[model samples]
Target: MLPLAAGPPFGPEHTMILEQAATALTLARLTSSPAWDRRAHSSVLLDLLHWRYRSRTEARLRAEALGLPTTGHRLVPVVVDHPGAPSADGVALTDHLASELLSSGVKALVGDLAEGRSGLLLALARASAWQPVVERIARELRAAFGPDVVVAVGPGVTELGQVTRSFREAEEVADAIGPASRDRPFHVASDIGLPELLYSLRDDVRLQKYVEQQLGRLVQHDARHGSDLLDTLRAYLDAAGNKSIAAKHVGLSRQAFYQRLHTIERLLGTDLESGAQRTQLHVAVTALESLGPPAELG
Candidate 1:
């Protein structure tokens, strides 16, 4: 068994913990019960605890709250206390209370990854949850954390006796692809499938080569021009192909935007205005999004 501080299901309790989490999700869905929702939240916390917390006592306390045994597992938890209007003490207290709640199994340990606009922006990147859905979460988080706080959640692994490799992988992807600016934030960790695909590519040279061939020119041009043309393209698509808006966003003049578009057209050997061409470009971009950044082509 792993040390109690190492994480979940090291020896005897693994099966039970997993069962409880699964059951909780099932119960919540089947019964439409808030209690089950609470349990699902607890499971999220449990996963976070296994990834972040450092002490056996801490681990035990968190598991116990979730109605799990602390005998064979540890708690790894990440707590983010935003610096917001209510004061540092408030944030600390909230974090402390949150830790206590996790110890009692009240919520997930992955705190809000971003604050205010940044959090909302990150949510916007998710096509699944539309504006209202993200807006509500953002509003609640803003009220709870206070206006100035920015938070983001990193991926975590909770299963005990497992390699730390996956955990480290999640953290690296989170950090590398996490939004540099809160204003235009995105949590790469939240999109589990994409990062998984990205890391998987490290082992698949053939697929990597294919991606390189498709995006080689764009990658090269970005390097040469010192501009994030890829991001610009994404932003343009996200804005529904509005050059004026794209220019305004990146602080370029309309003429410059047109010039860049021409350059992009020339380099990519595709027409942005054509429906068929735009559709293909969108598909390519989505595929590359899952692949993360491309390697420099020879």
Candidate 2:
């Protein structure tokens, strides 16, 4: 509330000014409250994650208002996905995570992405510092949410608009690991290697065409004959072109494995002995695996 002083000369204009001043005061009080602060943080963080702003100037202004550095800093996006039911106090989870990050002396903006998924943008003075900071965040999340949680860290970016790319990479990394994350709860985008490249291009028609061009004949053969030639090929390639090792992996005698290899060569019209051909086939096989149904995280 705002108090006003007036003399006999005061008119209706003065009354209007008083009302506006009181409204402004009320608004200031509301925006300064803790609840409003959390909402603002979440809103701005979501905007950054999705690249929602109209211009770089707009993004920098909003982030600067939140005390996030827009320059001289790199940001790494980390996503924690829990497939279980929400915690009893799920509404407060964002605040809890933010407090934990603060306690560890890490500067971050945290927000709840969904019922069981959370996103964090960690601002670092140096890009190399991301590893230790992400490791610390993983430990904190595991300690709080148990080992079933999947924590994925994406590549770092220097500009705020690039954050959306990092966020998506983190989500894709999480999707790639899926339920297998139970054994290894933490994953970094760089550590995922070839699959990371495949994931980025997983939806391209060219990638699917490449896979079909390399393995279509063999796949058709297996489907029509109920043969395990594809599996044999995978085992063979995994054994680094060593026939004895590949034979043992598929549980076949040397002669039988040789026959299967010959069959594969005839169907695909490619020689497995050529290192270049082997590399192409190996990549195609990996692409096929990556194209399979994505695993659900739990």
Over 1-298, each residue of candidate 2 has an lDDT whose tens digit, in order, gives 8778665897665665565456445545665565665666677778877788766767766666555676888888888887772452563556777777768776677777766777888889864667777777677667776777788888888988889888888988876664333466478765566655665566788988898889988888787788989999999999989999999988999999999999999999999999999999999888777677312100
Instruction: Give me the runs in candidate 2 sitting further than 4 Å from their true place.
Output: 1-38, 49-61, 64-76, 80-96, 102-105, 112-117, 123-130, 142-189, 293-298
Residue 1, candidate 1: how far off, in angstroms?
48
What are the per-residue Cα lDDT tens digits for candidate 1 across 1-298? 8565655536546655565567545554553543453444444443543455443444444444444442333322222324443533444333443444445443233333334111101111212323333234435445555554333333332443231344343344343332222331223344445434444344456655665655678888888778777777776766678888988988889897788788778888878898777766665565565555554343
- Candidate 2's TM-score: 0.66
Where is the poorest 10-residue window by lDDT in model 1? 116-125
- The per-residue C-alpha lDDT of model 2 at residue 39 equals 67
On a 0 to 100 scale, what is the lDDT of residue 259 in model 2?
99
